[model samples]
Target: MDERQAINAGKAALITLAVICLGALGVLVWEYATTKEVTNTAAVAVLLVSGGLFWAFERMFGAEAPRSLLGRELPTGATAAERAERRRAYAVDALALAISGVVLGIGGFMLGDPDAFGSLGLPGGPVTGAVLGFVALFVISFSLSWLVGEADSRAVEKRLARLEAQV
Candidate 1:
């Protein structure tokens, strides 16, 4: 087969594998939900092997392979305007994450206190766990945003340098 046909075949195989992996995961969840325990070692193995295979195939086929499989195009660097838009998007994501962190923190604090009305009947731990969770989530969200922005900026710089050198 030609290159396009080969790519299509590879994508189809990946999709099939993904479906199987998802099915395995669903089965594990179902088993856990029904029995309160997961005894399916085989299914877990399937998921682990599938993950390894997926990683290996992506390496073999190049980065675009999975993106194409997901019907997404590789981002071809970004302009200043696009970068600004991304920053706005990241800011929104950070805000959402912060709100979620606050909710989780309150929930954790309430859960840790036996006097709380919504206590889930578990052994209570320190309320500091809640504060830690909130802080961790806040830090992680901003760190991720910063890392992505930095990577995008570096990619743009490289592309610009290449273009300038060629001119």
Candidate 2:
């Protein structure tokens, strides 16, 4: 892939990863705030540092071949609309990450506040629930990011199909 394409692909990957991390954060925050768990303070700190490391990887990763949802690498010479669409998608991915972050933050807060669950006092035990919820979200996001990356590949395939038909 060319430099521009590589950068774009990296941006997309980074944005997606960020979103997943944010989702995890949301759950952590909610759990902590509601439970008033002190251990969460350390966990959140660890998460923040881990996020920074991930960002660093985005800058250092190898060349990226932009792919579509279908997993086909995009053509080097995509049309204006196609390229724009990809960029737009990347922006959305970034926004998704931001939303996830906020959710996780809220989750953490909820987890921290023991009084927050007052009305809902119908809980058997939130300890296991919180752990399970966070883990599930992180795993789901991890898988989704892997599959969604195929979007780039799919776009590439579509472009190729268009070119082939024109031939």
Question: lDDT for each of the candidates?
Answer: 0.63, 0.57
Estimate the lDDT of model 2.
0.57
Kindly list the per-residue Cα lDDT of model 1 for residues 79-130, writing each as its tens digit: 7775565555555666678767667657755677443223334444334544
Tens digit of per-residue lDDT, candidate 2, span 30-135? 8878987646665577578767867576435433456444455544345777656555554445445545654664576577955322234445555544444445
Worst 10 residues of 1 by lDDT: 61-70
Model 2: residues with Cα > 4 Å off, grouped in runs: 38-49, 61-167
C-alpha TM-score for every candidate: 0.52, 0.30
**Residue-level error in angstroms, candidate 1, position 89:** 5.2
**True lDDT of residue 77, candidate 2:** 41
Q: Roughly what TM-score does model 1 have, to 2 decimal places? A: 0.52
